[model samples]
Target: MSKPRSLSLAAYRVLSWGVRNGTDKPYIPRPEGELIWIHIASQDRQRVVEGFCQRLRQSRPNLSVLLTAPPQADLIRWDASSHPLVNLPSEQTGAAREFLDHWRPDLGLWVGGGLMPNVITRAEERGLPLILIEAEIDIHVARGARWLPDITRYTFDCFQTILATSPETVRHIRRLGVPASKVDTAPPLHVSPNPSPWPEDELIEMTHALSSRPVWLATWVQDKEFISVLSAHRQAMRMLPRLALILHVADMSETEPLHRRLLSMDLRCVNWDDGGTIEDTTQVILTSDPENLGLWYRLSPVAFMSSSLERGSGGRDPLTATALGSAVIHGPFVHRHQQLYDQLNRAGAARLVRTATELGDAVVELLAPDEAARMALAGWEIVSEGAPQTDHLIEIVQDSLDQRGQDHAST
Candidate 1:
């Protein structure tokens, strides 16, 4: 790599490390054979690629995965049943290249965009098979790349297989010289299926502590949505006086203001920031611990995916709520995850509310045992229907790998 590129990479690593304690996620070097390397640019979208790695590992246990992304996705949960996950050193393409050299991944999966051009070149030079899963060439990027046909072709030519989500992606890939035969239509990888295993003791404790109250959760709640949700909770409380509200913020920093706002309503509130219990009279519990959101969702039958009550906050994922059997409710602005929500809504698994009053009404109605159970059944049904998507993708990957191995032996 050139000096400038090397310096840029160094800066990237520094910024990533500074953002969070560098040691929160300790790195483990690559292991053995037939590894899959995934490079992701979007943090939110990284879950899809992770899902692919996880499912692939499930069917084929011996394979390994090396996941490299900068600050956006810095940590790897090292505890999954099979395979290992490692964070790539940011900007240090040399380190990334060296790691790949040692692991010698047979297949690479690049998710999302903005991957440096040289990274693709290095993988090609090493003869490592590359696939871009659910990839698209953004209009701004396509326009810029169009100015240089040679470079654009080189970028597009690097992929051995390309799975695209839309026609525009297919057109862009064709422009770069990939034969139509090599690019296939595939659904975006399913949401990762690993549900948080709520501890039996904790669940029992939560059940005892929070039982008999109608609990509702608003996850990843933002500023505008947070206020609306709090207001809705107050309004909903008129009908269901024992309503328990749980708020988990996308950023931990929002906890203080949210806490104060709840207190101003004279509603009993508690914060999990310092850790505690949900007392009998506690009206709201504010938490910044995201992992706790999973536990809360599992405990509550009704969940409102936040960042959706108002426009501009693109909305949050409802897959976890669905997978955990929580009846989901969201605002009308669910564009970021339209497909998942649409499927759930169509299945009668989730409801869309356009205003605070509507959301409050839905919460009150969903609290009914019969209604909540009905919604839960529908949500699970929709999730159950999509379970095979993960298996199908894994089967495709395995078959392709087996074919590649056979061809290599014949040649």
Candidate 2:
């Protein structure tokens, strides 16, 4: 190691110690249940880790997860009420030892990157079962792995199982002296379906009330696309007089304005955020609370996912509605989730509409029972295609934990 690099590492250790013991102590007391610690090094890997953690928690109610990432990494966006988030300590031996001593995690899951060789080696030395997922060898080179090739090899050897994301990564891990049998290429973990939080009775009541009515939903509609959605709804209403539209605004403050706009246009609108009821004459149900999306997705057989119609507005995830049995119709700006949208489009589960007229036509076509059923079934299949992989990962984690328990009991 060069003198400057060694000094930089020493400074990092001192900073880590100060952060831990200073006024902003990031440590949270470990919960009573079996705890699993996940170390995430890059912001790009946070989404996959969050999804895996969500599925793990759902599968094993008794298990708790502790997430640790570098201070600069953008962690998971969703509310992490159950899982506690903390900053990973510096890779210095003392800082790593201090972190492990405080949390005492039963199992450690390191995602993407071998940048923290010292911390990883320290955990393995302490008899912790460490698994590496989505391992990237480029991170090793970027962190100057060539400077201490032997140390890099030793660190890679710590992981009991290494799941590489590509063939190149697999070869890279093999070059680092990891056993060939221990490293295997695996696909990136996909996001699992997270059902919206809505009451069952409310869904039932809304379904019963909207029985036999032509209905569609515009979910997470941004302000810029309001006119387009309204125009599509108006066009659809002309073809089917009893057409009902659910306009779920992305911004809560826009709910009142949207309701006023509908009323000004002589459309019978119901404001859901203000305890307004959907009567027989109601043409549009305006709501800003996204929590009630489950109800709308269930009641409406066809839905248009928003944020996609306008330029520069990257699309929102459509799986949430698809998982709830809604056939999705999206706009042209879905580059953010292009792969997923492409899969759905190719599977005949979703339709892409670039104009308001196209949106209306798609809505009208999917309103038919047979058309809606076919699309919904296809969407459901696309959403469920990754179930086997998710289940397999969960089984591996559970089995590892079980074996650890058995070993402890035997001792």
Top of the candidates by lDDT = 2
lDDT computed for candidate 2? 0.79
| Model 1 stretches with alpha carbons more than 4 Å out | 1-34, 37-50, 57-104, 108-192, 395-411
lDDT of each: 0.72, 0.79
Candidate 2 stretches greater than 4 Å from native: 1-33, 40-45, 68-103, 139-145, 165-176, 184-187, 194-202, 311-313, 332-339, 346-348, 405-411
Measured against the true structure, the TM-scores of the candidates, in listed sequence, are 0.63, 0.80
**Candidate 2 C-alpha lDDT tens digits along 1-411:** 111234434433344332243544657777886999998877655645676787888888899899888744544544333578888764445666778888898888888874575577657777788888888873332233345435566667778888877999899889877789889987767666766468878777887777778899998899999999999998988888999999999889888887888899999999988999988888999998877777888888999999999987678778778888999999999876677788899999999999999999899999999999999999988777767667777887888788888888988
lDDT of 1: 0.72
Compared with the true structure, what per-residue lDDT tens digits does model 1 show for residues 89-177? 43334544655566677777777666554456556766666777777773212222334334545555677777888877888878777
Which structure among the candidates has the greatest TM-score? 2
Candidate 2, 290: how far from true, in Å?
2.6
